[model samples]
Target: MKFSDIIGHEEVRNEFDGLIKIGKISHAHIICGEDGSGKSFIARELAAKILGKTEIKDYADLIEWKINSGKKSISVDQVRSIIEEVNKKPYEGDKKVIIIHDADYITIQGQNALLKTIEEPPRGVFILLLCETMGRLLDTIRSRCQLHKIKKLPKEEMLAFINRKYGVLEDKEIKSILAFSVGVPGKVEDFMENTALKSIRDEVMDTLVSIKNMDYDNIVKCAQKLTEYKELWREVIECFAVYVRDSLIYKETGKEELIINSDKLEDVKKLAMQFSMNRLNRIFDILNFAKSNMESNVSVELTYGTMLFKIQEV
Candidate 1:
């Protein structure tokens, strides 16, 4: 996608263009943000401009235009291979661009191997690095590259983007999805693409309601079923968090805009009634904690079971 096509981050695009115009483009740039926050998109946009490929569709041609191009994960060999490409004269234009998506995944050895090239890249060699966590990068690498922090898009902007691209969604439903998106347009788009996410959302709400009513056996059964798809639990936790958060907002504002579960408000209301605000707040914290633990390689079954038992208490 071109910089103009990105839905949010106008200022960032402007600043990036300014750097390019002023001939102050750093040899390497680090674009940092949470997952699905458009880090990789921005990298490719810059790469396209540097490489003189104007049309978004032309990005696919990169694979054939060069000896080799297209998306490739960061690896030690990949980093080493870039040196050979950069050393050559630019073929398409004055600039040769290389994008290392998920740069945080680059091994320390890869970063060290890349140090010399980044320190003094060949003429017109632009390196773009996309990562969810800046802390994962080496300090030497961080010091050498320009850093850009991409925050979540505003809720209204995200909603408009989803609506503009996907056609009509109920205003209320769009707003709910926007709330759940948490400022990440990519994640927002993912929700649109994955129809199963909706079903999982419904099931999570059902399971939460079951918990509030002290349906112990049912909650256990639901948790067991959830353990079957370990990858989904993170999504489920985020969806559930947004679902309850919006209910609290609805309770305060009495506006449809304040609710994220327009299609399932009855279940939301039921659970909101059964738990105190203090307890709901704790549940949100626990959900976030559980998500963190799950990512840290904690046993999914034990993690989810403990989470379920606590939800049942509520």
Candidate 2:
């Protein structure tokens, strides 16, 4: 994809284009952003432009590296191979571009292996590192690269893009999708394509509403059901958090417009009555803790079980 094809980040696009026009390309660049925020897309497009090719596949000088499926980290051997490759002259283009997708997956050893190349690359060599967050990378590695932080599209921009691409969706449906997207277009597109995701979201909301009343056996069953969709646990947790937060807001302001789950206004209002402000705050904290723990390699079933029990107590 070309830079023009990217929906947002106009300022960043302009800056890159200006840099290219001025012939002052940096040897190393770190493109950091949330997943589904177009970090990889932008990096590839920039690499293509740097290689003077209209398409990525047509650019013989472009070397792409990504973490293999089911792999926790990109190994040091992979970085070493790229180091060897970069030492050679470009085969078909004036510039050689290396795009490392999910750069955060590069282990400490891998990062150290890449350090010398990044520090003193050959002429016409450019390295683009795409990562979800910069904190995972070594500070020394980060210091050697020009950092570009990409953010998600604003609500209006995202809605416009969704409308243009998906045609007409119900207003409520659009709002629901936006709520789930958390400002990420890739996420919005995923919600659009995966019909089952919406159903699962609804199921999560229903289960959460009834969780406090469930017996121990039923709670275990509920956790088991959640575990079956472990791949979507993050989204489920975020959606549930938003629902609880909106209920609390509605309780305070009595403003239906302020609630994201507008279709479930009555239910939210009833649930709001059941939770005092402090109780709702604690539940929100529990959901956020669950998300953090899940990212730290905690067991999904155990995390969900604990979260559910804490919600029941709240």
Candidate 3:
């Protein structure tokens, strides 16, 4: 994609532009950010600008290295082959651009193998490593690269983005999306493309609203049901956090504008009226606890069950 198409992070773009214009290009570069924060897009945007291409596609001088299909991690063999290719002169452009996707998934051996190239590549060579987590890379490797980060967009930017691209959507839907995406531009599109993600959101909201009156048997069933979405517990908890947070906000201020779940205003109001302020705060604590436990590798069922039980108790 074109750099103009990208929103936010103008400073990083400007710095990169200056680097290219002055021919002070760093040999190794790291583009790091969270998932759906557009790290990959930014890397390609830079690559396109460097390669003088309007679109992101394979170019003779642009080498794309990603994990192979069905592969768990990038192998040393792949790294060696790419290194060999880079040693050769660029076939098209004056400089060679190597874009490594999912750089964090490179095996330890692969990283070590690629270390020397990153430290001292041939003249006119530039390497872009795109990673979701910088900790996965060796300190020596990270220390050698010029790091560029794609940060989350601010609320105003995100809102303007939605208005520009999805202006036809109702205000309630826009507000829900604004709240759900939480200032991540790429996540707004991800939620639209993944219909099942929204399904999980609806299920979470419904289960949460019903949890207060559920009998012990029903609570267990609900927890069991939640465990079925093994890979999506985080999304489920995020939905819970958003809805509950909005409910608490609305209850305290009686200001609809202050809350994000405007589409679910009736339900939010219902929740506020049903629970005390103390209970609402307790539920937030429970959600945070469950999220921490899940991230720590706790059993999913136990976390979900405990969260529901504590929320019910409060």
TM-score of each: 0.82, 0.89, 0.82
Model 1 lDDT per residue over 1-314, tens place:
54567778777777887887887878889889988887766777777766666745454313211112554346677776766766777666667777766778777888898888888987777877778898889999999999999988887787678877888878766755665677888777777787767677777777777775656677667877778767777787887788778667666666775565666777767776777788888888888888988988898878887788886675
Write the residue-wise lDDT of candidate 3 on 191-258 in tens digits. Answer: 77777677777778888788878999998888898888878887789888888888889889999877
lDDT of each: 0.74, 0.85, 0.84
Candidate 3: lDDT of 168?
73
lDDT of 2 at 265: 75
Task: Tell me the alpha-carbon RMSD of every candidate.
Answer: 3.9, 2.4, 3.4
| lDDT agreement of model 1 with the native | 0.74
Candidate 1 lDDT score at position 77: 78
Ranking of candidates on lDDT, top first: 2, 3, 1
Model 3: colliding residue pairs: none
Q: Mind sharing the TM-score for model 2?
A: 0.89
Ten residues in sequence with the least summed lDDT for candidate 3: 1-10
| Cα deviation of 173, candidate 1, in Å | 4.5
| Cα lDDT over the full model 3 | 0.84
Residues 48-126, model 2: lDDT tens digits: 8787767544467888888878888899998888899888899986789988888988999999999999999999999
